[model samples]
Target: MSGSWAGGRFGERGECLLAPNPGIMTLDGTNTWVLREPGSSTAVVVDPGPVEDGHLERLDEETGDVGLVLLTHHHLDHSEVAATFAARKGCAVRALDPAHCVGADPLADDEVLSVGGLSLRVVATPGHTADSVSFLLPTERVLLSGDMVLGRGTTVVAHPDGRLGPYFDSIERMRSLATAGEVATIWPAHGPVHDDAGAVLDHYLAHRRDRLAQVAAAVERLRDEGATPTPRAVVEVVYADVDEILWGAAELSVRAQLEYLAERAS
Candidate 1:
């Protein structure tokens, strides 16, 4: 069902449940997902979302017994409630980063975790964060993509914690999985569920490439105009069409791109 606090389910094999946590940094809101095997009693919880009490209560109501709490990344919005939720359910919270994990085990790539006979394969998808990962549910051909891919708009590279090259590689990796028919839908951390996994992944990859090209063009434009080719000036030109609110974020991406370009030039 769709509502202000919750979203509908998708696919016959598993549900694409959502717990919306709308806020400033969250854009619309963070999505806490519940994925269960068809006709199973236990379910796997992905990204427990923020520490909102109401959300935790809703989670309790939605999932009676959680088998595991799997985190895609360590972003606050996605991982803030993991510890609490895991404690409440007496389940383990698994993540790639040990720091973000409470008492649960650290997740590893290629590991297959089973909950109520349903298995999930972990895929390391860093770049959104050094510890980012995606879960592949083969039975449903569904991928639970965390911050690596969003439902609404593009995700920030999150510089310092996130990088451009690895981000591109992660997208391509997801695309390859989709191309292989390993993924039919994407259950992202934010926004609605996506049915066209392959096309969406392709679009995400192409968009990043296009943005890099735009950054290059912006650098060229500034040089032609005789403006200083510093990161700040480059940001002004490359992100001219972007809102001031997002320019700061754009600048980070620009800086990352500039660094990549500089390294390549050398």
Candidate 2:
């Protein structure tokens, strides 16, 4: 909230229109990306964002001709108005999940989508949610990392549909892309855009490892005390310094960590 991340234009092909919905979970707001290749007549929209009147009006102005609407994930904030926006623009909305896609095939891993001479490679970076996916714009060396990587802080590995192991793999995948110079920047869904994709990814991975260790230590101490630690109990100890309003999100991460530990032990 204190940063200069008011979300604006990136390189030549990308422009971010920050949504109006700002809160604890969604930092700033959802970033609606307008992507257009140089000398192209049509634009490709990514994550139409929550259906806000003012935001939508601004977005409509920013993107005069949209050839396609793409969702980073099935998250309501990211995809709730994708269908409506796409319908209004006379374009198809495509996502990994069938329930959210409209008039387009489900996105496949490593699929290259070319519209208006712009190429977007679908990199299946799930684990924030099973339907989560990141787009790799090889031209700009940028990754539109849905909820996998954030600009300000770390991301939550939501339990149930979101698992730790896959999140680990997904981060590693992005890391490889960064190290290989295929991706230099990360355009996250929630926060601002990251120019240092490698550094940001490394920080994200390190934070996860450190938090997992902390959770394991807490779990061990609780077990030694003959107490079975629930997710909330683990959160109480591990995330004592964090805001209580975020304990619910921290609990989700703790649950994922516990599940990872259990799987490792097994």
Provide TM-scores for the models.
0.91, 0.97
lDDT score at residue 252, model 2, on the 0-100 scale: 89
* Per-residue accuracy of model 2 over 151-221 as CA lDDT, tens digit each: 78989888878999999999999999999989999999988888899999999999999999999999988
Worst 10 residues of 1 by lDDT: 1-10
Q: Candidate 1: which pairs clash?
A: none
Report, for every candidate in turn, its global Cα lDDT versus the true structure: 0.81, 0.90
After superposition, candidate 2 runs with Cα above 4 Å error:
none
Listed per candidate, the RMSD to the true structure in angstroms reads 2.6, 1.2
Error of 2 at 247 (Å): 0.2
Best by TM-score: 2
Q: Pick the candidate with the highest lDDT.
A: 2
